[model samples]
Structure formats: C-alpha cells, structure tokens
Target: MKILLPVDGSECALRAVDHLIAHAAWYREVPEIHLLHVHPPIPIGRVQAHVGEDTLKAYYLEESQASLLAAQQKLDAAGRFHTTHIHVGQPAEIIAKMAKDLGCDLIVMGTHGRGAVAGLVMGSVANRLLHSAPCPVMLVR
Candidate 1:
C-alpha cells in the first residue's frame, strides 16, 4: 500500500506519525510511505516582486524543510523510510491532490479534534481532506 502522510510539525501532527509506527506491523507488507508538507503560496504582488522568484522559492524550501523535519526524524527513528514532497498551495487541496498523484491507497494524517462548531469557524484541513481526498483518509487525533 502507498500511504500519503501529511505533516505540519505540530504535536497533533506527530500523533499521526506515532500511529503509523505503532500499527505498521498490522499490514501484510511494509507500506510505501510519502510524507507531504504544504505551504501557502507566496504573495505574488508585493513579496514576490520584492524578494524575487529564486529567493521566494528558497524561503518556501526552508519552511517546508522545517515542517518536514520532525516527521522525518520520527519515521527514521522507527526505521521507516519515505519519500518527501513539498507543495505550495492550500493545505487540504494540496494534500488531496498529492494523494491522487502519488497513486496512494490511503491518506493518513493528524486532526486537531476540534468540535464541529470550532471546525466550522477554524476551517479544518482534516474536514476538507475527509470530503475531498481521492482515497480513504485515516485521521489520528
């Protein structure tokens, strides 16, 4: 199975990594893993114009690296290797798109476990992924 794992470097996100590590043996074979971190697009008019494309791209790379580091460390400590993907866009949309592009059977990610009202107010990525992901989504709270 190919699993798409979205990580944000938060404590809640780490729960998803832990879940994968704890339950990996349940599968018939070791799953192929893909770790994804999505960053919001750079401001096109002001920031990009001032910073230039290369600098903005560098910033995105730096931020994405910071976000993926913890997840990478956790997976490495568990002895699971994974491919890394960094995308620039809305988190929910990017995550869903990456899952399909990677031909993944499942998307495993963390949820903040916000209440429905809170989710509505906060606009949760998990809620969006649940509705839009191409494959089944497993959320670790």
Candidate 2:
C-alpha cells in the first residue's frame, strides 16, 4: 500500500508519524510512504514584491524543509525509506491534491484536536481533507 503522510511538526503530527512507524510491521508488505509538508502561501503581493520571486521561492523552501526535519529524522532513524515533498498552499487542498497526484491509496495525517467550537470557527484541515481527499483518510491526534 502507498501511504501519504502529512506532517506539520506539531506534537500531534509527530504522534501520527509515531503511530505509523509502530504499526508498519502489521502490514504484509512494507508500505511506500510519502511524507509531505505544506506551508501557507506567501502573502499575496507584499512579501513576494519585496523579496522577488526567486528569493520568495527560497524562503518557502527553507521554511518547509525545516518543518519536515523532525519527521524526516524519525523516519531516517527507523531506516524507513520514503520520499518527501513540500508545497505552498492551503494545507488541505495541497494534501488532497498530492495524494491524488502520487496515486496514494491511503492518507494518514495528524489533527490539532481543536474543540468543536474552535474547529467550526477556524475550520479544520483534517475535516476538509476528509471531504476532499480521493482516498481514505486516517486522522491521528
């Protein structure tokens, strides 16, 4: 099975990663893992205008790479072979899109575990992905 794992470097996100690592042995065949981090898009006009396109791109790359580091280290330590990706956009949208593009059979992600009221007001990425993702989504808090 191909699993798409999205990590934001939150304790919750790392929890999801840990869960997957522990359960990996349950599967008959080792699954292919795709690790992804989605950074919010650069502010519409100001940051891009000030930094220039190339510099803005560099900034996005740096931040996203940093966000992925903890998860990457854990995977490395476990000797798990996987591919990593970074994108700038709405996290839910990017995650759903990436799963489809990569032909992932399942999506395993972490949730921030907001209260229902807070989630309804601020919205939840995991909730959005549940509706938008083409494949099954497993959310770990």
Candidate 3:
C-alpha cells in the first residue's frame, strides 16, 4: 500500500508521523511512503515580479524543507524509506490531488483537534480532506 503523509511542521503533524511509524507493521508489507509539504500561495500579486521567480522558488524550498525536516528525520530513524514533495497551493486541495496522482491507498495527516465550532470557523484541512481525498484519510491528533 502507498501512504501519503502531509507535514506542516506542527507538533500535531509530527504526532501523525509518529502514529504512522508506530503502526506501520500493521500492514501486510512495509508500505511505500510519500511526504508532502504544501506552501500556501503568497497573496502578494506583484511580489513575484519584485522577488523574481528564482527567489520565490528558493523561499518555497526553504520553507518546505523546514516543515519537512523533523518528519523526514523521524522516518529516517525508523528506517522507513520514503520520498518527499513540495508544492504551492491550498493545503487540502494539494494533498488530495497528490494522493490521487500518486495513486496512494491512504492519506495520513494530523489535526489540531479543535472543537466543532472552531473547526468550522477555522476551516480545518483535515476535515476538508476527509471529504475530498480520493483515498481514505486517517487523521491523528
């Protein structure tokens, strides 16, 4: 099975990674794992023109790397083989799309564990992915 793990550098997100690593043996075989970090688009319209494409790309790389670092280290320490990807867009949409494109069997991610009202007001990506992901989504708190 293929699993898509999304990391956002939050402790909650790391918890999700830990949960996956802990339960990895539940699968029949060691699953193929893919780590994804989605950078939200900068709202500045003309900022790209001022910053240049290369600079923006570098920013994305730097931020994504920071967000992915701990998760990567955890997987590495667990001796779990995996691949990493970085993208810019809405997190939920990007995550769901990546799962479909990679033909992943499951998507594992972390949740902030907000109350129902807060989740609705804040627009939880976990909640959104639950509805839109092509594959099953497992949320760890």
Candidate 4:
C-alpha cells in the first residue's frame, strides 16, 4: 500500500506522522510512504514581479525543506522509508492531485480539529481533502 502524507510543519501535522508510525505494524507489510509539502504560491502582483523565477523556486524549496524537516526526522528515527515531494499551490488541491498522480491507496494528514463554524470561516484543508481526495483520508487531530 502506498500512503501519501501531507505535512505543513504544524504540531497537528506532526501528529499525523506520529499516528502513522505508531500504527505501521498493523499493515501486512510496511507501506510505501510519500511525504508531501505544498507551499502557497506568492501572490502574482509585487512579489513575483520583484523576484526572479529561479529565486522564487529557491524560496519555495527552502520553505518546503523547513516544513518537512521535523517529519523527516521522526520518520528517520522510526526507521520508516519515505520519498519526499515539494510543490507550490493550494494545499488541498495539490495534495489531492499528488495522491492521485502517485496512485496512493490512502492519504494521512493532521487537522486543526476546528468546529464547523470555525472551519467554515477559516477554511479547512482536511475537510476539503476528505471530500476531494481520490483515496481514503485519515486525519489525525
């Protein structure tokens, strides 16, 4: 089984990683893990106009690397093998697409666990993923 784990370097996100590591032995064999970090695109107005394409790319790379670091360290400590991917886009859309493109059997992620009103006001990527992701989505709070 292949599992796509989307992380944003939040404490909530790391909980998802921990949840996966804790439950890994339940599977028939170790699952193939894909660690994905999506960076929100810089607005097209001033930031893009001011920064070179290569510089923007580097910025995204740097941010994604920072966001992925803790998750990677935890996985490494657990002796879990995973491949990392970085992208720049809306998180929910990027995550769903990556899960499908990678042919993932499941998506594991963490949620802020907001109430419906708060979620509606703030927007919930986990909720969006639950509805849009091609595979089953497991959310860790």
Candidate 5:
C-alpha cells in the first residue's frame, strides 16, 4: 500500500506517525510511506517589498526541508519504510494533490495542526482532507 502521511511538526502530527508505526503490520504488504510537509505560501507583495523572491523561496524551502528531516528522523527511528516530500502551498490541497499524483491508497494525518484560530475558522487540515481526498483518509487526533 502507498500511504501519504502529512506532518506539520506538531505533537498531533507526530501522533499520526506513531499510530502508523504501531499499526504498520496490519497491512499484508509493507507500505510505502510518503511523509509530507507543506510550507505555507510566501506573501508575494510583502516578500517582494522586504526580501527578494529568491530569498523568500530559499527560506521557505529551507524550513520545509528542516521539517521534513525532523519527520524523517522519527520515521527512521520507528523503522518504517518511507520517503519525504516538502511542498509549498495550502496544506490540505497539497496533500490531496500529492496523494493523487503519488497514487497513494490512503492518507493518514492529524485532526488538529499547529494553529488554533485557523483550525477553528477554516477547520483542520485533516477535516479539509477528509472532505476532499481522493482516497481513504485516516485522521489521528
């Protein structure tokens, strides 16, 4: 099975990883896990006025990579089979698109992310994903 797990470096996100680790053996075949971290888009006008586009892009990319690396370390320590993806966009949209593009059979992610206000207003990433995902989505609270 191809599984896409999106992490935002939150305890809730890590909980999803922990759940996956504990339940990995349930699948008949070893799953190919894709650990995804989506960096929010840089505000074009503000970024251009302060920092150049290249610098903004580089900063976002660097941060995304760091998040991915952190998640990778956790997965590695758990001895799970996986790869990492760092994207720049809305978290829910990017995760769903990635699942479609990667042919993922399932998307396992957290119900609540880092931001409390945004999650309350716009709903959580897992909530959005559950409504729009192409495949089965498992939400770890």
Candidate 6:
C-alpha cells in the first residue's frame, strides 16, 4: 500500500509517524510512505517590496526543505521506507493534490495542526482531507 503522510514539523504531525511505526506489521505488505511538508505561500505584497521575488521563493524552499529534513529524520529513526516532498501552498489542498497525483491509496496525518483560530475556523488539515481526499484518510490524533 502507498501511504501519504502530511507533516508540518509539529509534534502532533510526528505523532502520525509514531502511530504508523508502531503498527507497521498490520498491513499485509510493507507500505511505501510519502512524507509531505507544505510551506505557507509567500505574501505577494512582500514579494513586491523589500524581499525580491527570488529571495522570497528561496526562503520558502529553504523552510520547506528544513521541515522535510526533520520529518525524514523521524521516519528514518523508525526504519520506514519513505520519500519526502516540499510543496508551497495551503497544506490541505497541497496534501490532497499530492495524494491524488501520486496515486496513494491512503493518507495518514494529524488531526490538529499548528494554526490556532484559522485551524478551528476553516477546519484542520485532517478534517479537510477527510472530506475532500479522493482516497481513504486516517487521522492520527
């Protein structure tokens, strides 16, 4: 099975990795894990101001890479077969798109993320993926 694991370097997100590691043998075969980190979009106004477009883009890439690295470390420690991706967009949208694009059978992610009021207002990544994902979704709380 192919499993898409969306993470934001949050403890809650890492919990999903922990859950997968603890339950690896439940699946009939060793699953291929896709670890995804979606970076927040750069502000358009800032891109036109003090920060050049290239610089802002570089910043986003760098941040996303860092997040991916952290996630890789966790997955590595767990001895799982996985690949990392860094995307720039809304987390929920990017996650859903990536899962569809990659033809993943399922998504394993955290229910609560880093956002405060926004997460509560618009719903968390897990909630959005649960309602919108094309495949099955497993939320780790």
Per-residue lDDT for 7-32 in model 5, tens only?
88888788889899899988999999
Stretches of model 4 off by over 4 angstroms after superposition: 113-123
TM-score of each: 0.91, 0.91, 0.92, 0.92, 0.90, 0.89
Give lDDT tens digits, candidate 2, residues 1-141: 999999877788888889889899977899999999988786777765567888888888998888889889998899888899989898889999999999999998887632233274323888788889999998886
- Answer with 2 or 3, whichever has the higher lDDT: 3
Each prediction's total of clashing residue pairs, residues at least 3 apart in sequence or on different chains, is: 0, 0, 0, 0, 0, 0
- Candidate 6 runs further than 4 Å off: 118-123
Tens digit per residue, CA lDDT, model 6, 1-141 = 999998877777878888988999999999999988888776687557788878877898888777667668877987887988888898888898999999999898878777553465433677777778989988887
Instruction: Give each model's whole-structure lDDT.
Output: 0.86, 0.85, 0.88, 0.88, 0.84, 0.82
Model 2 Cα shift for residue 40 (angstroms) = 0.7
- C-alpha-based local distance difference test score of model 5: 0.84
- The residue ranges of model 2 lying beyond 4 angstroms of the native Cα positions read 113-123
Q: How does residue 81 of candidate 6 score in lDDT?
A: 74
How displaced is residue 141 in candidate 2, in Å? 1.4
Which of candidates 5 and 6 is the stronger one according to lDDT?
A: 5
How many clashing pairs does model 2 include? 0
For candidate 6, the 10 contiguous residues with the lowest summed lDDT are 115-124
lDDT by residue (tens digit), candidate 1, 1-141: 999999878787888999999999988999999999888785687775578788888999998899899899999999998999999998889988899988999998888532233384333888878889999998887
Clashes by residue pair, model 5 = none
